[model samples]
Target: MAGMMRRSLDAFCITFWITVFLAAISSATPIEPRSNAIQELWSSVRTLVFPPTNRCKVYPGDPEWPSDDVWMKLNKATDNRLLVKPQPQASVCYSGPFYNAEKCAEITPVWGSSYTHIHDPIEMMSPVAQGMTCLPPNVFDSHNCSRGGFPMYVINATEPKHVQLGVDFARKTGVRLVVKNTGHDFLGKSGGKDSLSIWTHHFKQIDYIEKFEDKKLGYSGPAFKAGVGVQAFEIYKAAHEKGRTVVGGEGETVGIFGGYIQGGGHSPLTSLYGTGADQVLSFDVVTADGKFVTANSTSHPDLFWAMRGGGGSTFGVATSVTVKAHPEMTTTASRFSFTSKDIGNETFWAGVRTYVDYFIPNADAGTYAYFLLLPNVATGIFTFSMSPFFAPNKTLEQTQTLLQPWFTRLNDLGITFDPNITQFDSYYEAWRSSFPLEVVEKINATTGSRMFPRANFETEAKREELYQNLRKSSENNRVQVHFNIKAVDPANADNAVNPAWRPNILFAQQAVRWPVNATAAQILKIRQDFQTGDMQRWRDISPGAGSYLAEADRLEPNFGQAFWGTKYARLLRLKTKWDPQDVFFATTSVGSERWKVESVDGLPNENGKLCRVR
Candidate 1:
């Protein structure tokens, strides 16, 4: 009798699923009907037997999780490019099945560098975002290495179709999805737990288009269509070879066509040629419905506007982008440093005040200054290091002339420092010589940033206030300042970048780092102090100003307004329209407030199951 009942139930289930599947196919769109119907039927059947209480995304152990057969089918669909059950890059450091002492020793030395992580399929440059679960084994701890927040599987996507296949599979299977280009994401957006990742690091195609014309936008110039995997140095070199230059980030390994431009990339060339987003001609992206489309001023204008600075992994996956290229020009580079020990604290801060006062004039002169202000509490010393201040289209004498007033002021203040200024014939040469390789893998540090507008430097009182706040903020933290002001073009002002950036004169970041192997409570305290204490000082001064979304505090409050400002509403609307199902989830991105990552032990972490809150 039991067998008879079981047979009857099975028959009923099959009949119900077939009816639902057929109905779905009839109502579904032409592009996704058959596959959608099958996936819906499978999910419906699983829900009937084992219902989920939270309506959360399917986890690996859940009954609704895609079967091995389903993953196999996806692999076959992608032409067998799927990488299943991949281990973390640091897995070799631990006693694991893939352990190797020689390989571990070799990797351990360069493990902290961004170069080591950029080429990896799933490794992230920011280890803290990955929960620091698997790192080179240190003497302080004996924790076992795990995947942590890294994706469980990856699609080594060499083409757009592979990306489409990966997106469709994740959407259909109710699994988390993430897109990784160079793993250079600082906010953990490129990695997620129990996710199926689309690895776009192999999209290394670069084509230069001469006399590219866009009638709708009235753009006719030299442009380069770079693949998703193209890095800053690669594009810079390519453009230099063609006797042209492109606006890009300072970091050599930063992906240009992906997150950099999408987040309104600020560059040493920004003051001269506008932002990286402003230079964009078009983007080839795979939207939420797994449809590949090109977004430009003429076609899909809204998507184009949003894609320019809407932040990455929110609207869609970008496959390639065509960006404007400018004629190669000369650049003047300067490097100098002085410590408070040389001059008293009063004189050092006075020098800083003079430097702050020159921000507006520097912006007017189209100069980009990148420097660091580090104050050590224990040693009672303040160190100011200007690795290289970049001035484009200016000769060495012209650059020095611009800085003569500041130099005179320093001399009067009894501050002795050498201005190691030099000139390069090309922007690429100056960039190569000026900017040092950025160090990554700061697992214990938390950062917050602010964009200071031109008004902050207008009056002596305002300048004094800015200097005081900066000094107070740097008392217990490190401050990295970039005097990169955007030269906004009226034609491209409709992008979704933080509006505060338009009139901004400088961007300042405050960072706090704790010792390695700090306790969870200690780490929490450090992060809290950095946010509420150090960053709050900047926030109090810049009331209406916003921060650069790409390099901001991960747990920032009111992130929408902080990142997008007045544009947040429109960006959210576009996000809903393009990705209604919320298939994409990046930390602090548009429409992300509706979802939450269930962190472990009351600490902020992405290494947990993501679920909808509403």
Candidate 2:
């Protein structure tokens, strides 16, 4: 079985790249030469970088579609594992092409949940990716699923060689390339138009190294090597069974070592330890040049630093990551909330403002809280912010004592509340109880966020201004605002993560959800408003502060300053050195500003091409 699997995987990659190479050669276009030394020199560079080919891509409806012989050869190469499944847009939508309205209606109710979407390897839970270009904006509109915003083909990559093949094929053939692990990206980075995607969902492997040591970094500890397909829950479970714990996301389905850690992941453990990127020991990756290399503090050190927090799909395809593991500890868990009976009530705002003010102190006390503020228009009251927090190495009584001040402030303001606090003997237990509640179904929403430093919570005047602006913007736009309170100090472990994370006590996020029937202009306006209006308060309150790129505003102005801060310039230079021909491009990545997705009538069309700005 092992030999068969190996041969099948090998054949799949070999056949796929061979077909791409043949396609490129068949599609070559004749160019008129300028007949000058300078032009010829430049032409040589261009040809070396982007080899011209006529048969590179077999687009739908193209005359050069693969013949039966070609299909049989490719199938034999892959041991009949190559997949040609089109986008399943219609499977869950009433407007989808294959299903009747009645049957589609039946599927919609069950499929509308976030769990259902995340379970599928390809479907993006949010309608944004689904409706970006092809599917009708209206979820209920009857239409056939179109491959407008999705990849034209996908290779089910189960090994590093498959990834290398996809990367080399894309570079050599001049076709767009994307990597998908769990398809849980917030910005739809996993999808691209007329692109070839390498799906690493099948690459599930976990190995633990006892007394793992890196001689160059002068460190030694226990570490777990997680494959690209591994999720947070899997690692947490495996680590726990081995008498250890790992730093990971709150979501159960989130890919741990994939894009999460690459974007400088934060967690309840961040306050006590450091950012997720700080736990990295080594990474096994396939570079753009089709070489599989192990990057660590000693080898390919620059690539190691960049991949830690620089953002995904910009450098190369990561196959596995070995991260630090900490000893397991007990935790105190609590969930708190207070709802106002009257909307815009002065007393409610004052009390909530006081709670917000305590964010810094809470983190300093080794508590991590995931909180959200919601205004209840129907009840004419605020559905006060909710916080599910966990304190490590703290008893139930100590945890309650730490939280008593905030409760007193709420009581002083005559606020009502029902708080659920509990104690767990282990970190894993505390996580399983509350983290599941964090799951969200995909919606038509766009987020804008900021990292609020200690200064924002230090002064009373600043606190008042921050809360007032937050309330105004959130209430005015009917947006939901959230905060992740974590006091992170990386202990001088240098990497490409935004410098703003080091001093920040609160990570603030605001999201605007649009109506399904809204016009393109309205949607665009909402997107624009998120940057200028909705996020204005965050920008004003935290000037020079950056955001977490994994979930920040997509249309962020001066994005380099907002996402990477002073690190952007260095990241750009490294990007050129690693991928000089720009083999990979994801929206809002390190060097994405140089390209634009094709748009028509002031809105992006799914069928339009992604062209270089120059």
Candidate 3:
């Protein structure tokens, strides 16, 4: 029986690689036809001799897994920058040889902040994606420590050559590959079980260009070339220092060039300028074939389009990206809060409806509002908190005038809430003071989000329906709403961003968390109820709308349509052409549907081996 099973696996591997080789050849550029064909043929034969068990990627304990000597060669090839046998960040908190009570105590206090995880080579911000293997001692009882879903080894990449070497090693050895930059990914795309990781957090070089000329794209403007590891605040401050600004994210720690821009980043500046992806000019990447290339409008246009908004870690590993920078301008910002304690549920929800009603006008005025709705039935408390509302290039009186209608409605409803508005001379000053430091590291919660299109608010009836659906969804989950809308330029509309986003007015995200010690069945129930039950309310009202890929549900159904919409088919084709060997794997990334991560005990995690399912 064992011999027969082995024969079957061998046959399947050969056939699979043969198909892959043919597909790759058809898409291979004429310049590298001979070399590409030879490489594909060699890879296919290698797979036939050492077939992956269950058609999965190579994992530890497998005969095909690299030997110590082989890893040493990789380490030397990359100037001894390879981190062998990397461990999880919280491993020291567990009862193990690596445990140190003092160090664990220090880590525990800052575990919730993204700053702590961003510095670690292998740590991810979300513990749920980390497979909940090891957490701070205070969060749970000290248990066995394991690497869990993190990569087995990491190349502390500081340059494009290091990324190329890592990509080549993973491809040749058939080991799963993942890229990590700042470890701010919400979908756990940065980590994978038994994978080789390229840690790009050290690529912190940023160069400012006073005049960036791209004749092919018919543009010449001020721009910045930022390394993949450059964070939001860093670029914002740098651009401000040069008397310019660029589209960026709300979270100060979010990487500007990696997943943030690649996932169609939305921001306070989105209303005035555009999405973060729209500001991109070009990307320098290491392709799957281990070649370093620059992808721009004139060179590798398809790859450039896919990388702009197709989602990251799919086509290639980007070393740096150049983005357009706009002139810095004055801004108006505000913060206010009201709760059910101040009013009744009906009036509170009514106030929320008034706020939703103004999303279109506010977006038209080039304003962005980030707010939260927290409803706790058990405590009989509901809160609406707008940490800050940003109105770029607008004065204090102008912003107040734009929001007067909503305030009038609130006054009519007898809702008294202070609109603590303030004006700043520069966008950086307002941004630094307005947006609060985001609290991360939610181990027990799973998140789902949707982008609500403008058509949903075309009529009063439709608007009411949207409000009621949101109110119902908020009853069981906290809802975060960002009023960001923009119409894509015809010249830049060919990218892979969801069509729903162009006509969208709101991006809302909701999270559902389970108890720390919940049973497997209980956790499964929470996830199912949230995705299919609570989130479905938002989905039903906004038919044909899409969700934000960066902050979307992990188990979103029909994710191809939900994340990329009409652009999914083209994105898939581009993914196939560039990464024919499927060298890169991230959860729900482009082409990820072809692979499956087997879970343990109903939890959604990357702890298991990744197998080719299609």
Clashes of each: 0, 13, 0
Q: Estimate the overall C-alpha local distance difference test score of candidate 2.
A: 0.71
Error of 3 at 9 (Å): 13
lDDT of 3 by residue, 1-614 (tens): 99999999979887886676455434533323335433433343343223333488888787777777677767766768999978777778877788888888888888888888778888887778768777786775537777778889999998787787788777766788989988777778888887899999888999999899987766798999999999988999999999998899888988889988998888888877778888888999998887889999899999999998998889999999999999888899989999988688889888889887888888878888888888786777788888788888999999999989999999899999899999999999999999977666577787888888888887888889988887876776554555545544435545777777788888888888788889879988889888888788889888999888888778888888999998999999999999977888788888888898886655778777888886
Sort order, TM-score high to low: 1, 3, 2
On the 0 to 100 scale, the lDDT of residue 408 in model 3 is 99
Query: CA RMSD for every model?
Result: 4.2, 10.1, 4.4
- The TM-score measured for candidate 3 stands at 0.92
Provide TM-scores for the models: 0.92, 0.86, 0.92
Compare candidates 1 and 3 on lDDT and give the better one: 1
Worst 10 residues of 1 by lDDT: 45-54
Candidate 3: the clashing residue pairs are none
Per-residue error for 217 in candidate 3, Å, reads 2.3
Q: Which ten residues in a row have the lowest lDDT in candidate 3?
A: 44-53
Error of 1 at 159 (Å): 0.7
lDDT of 3: 0.82
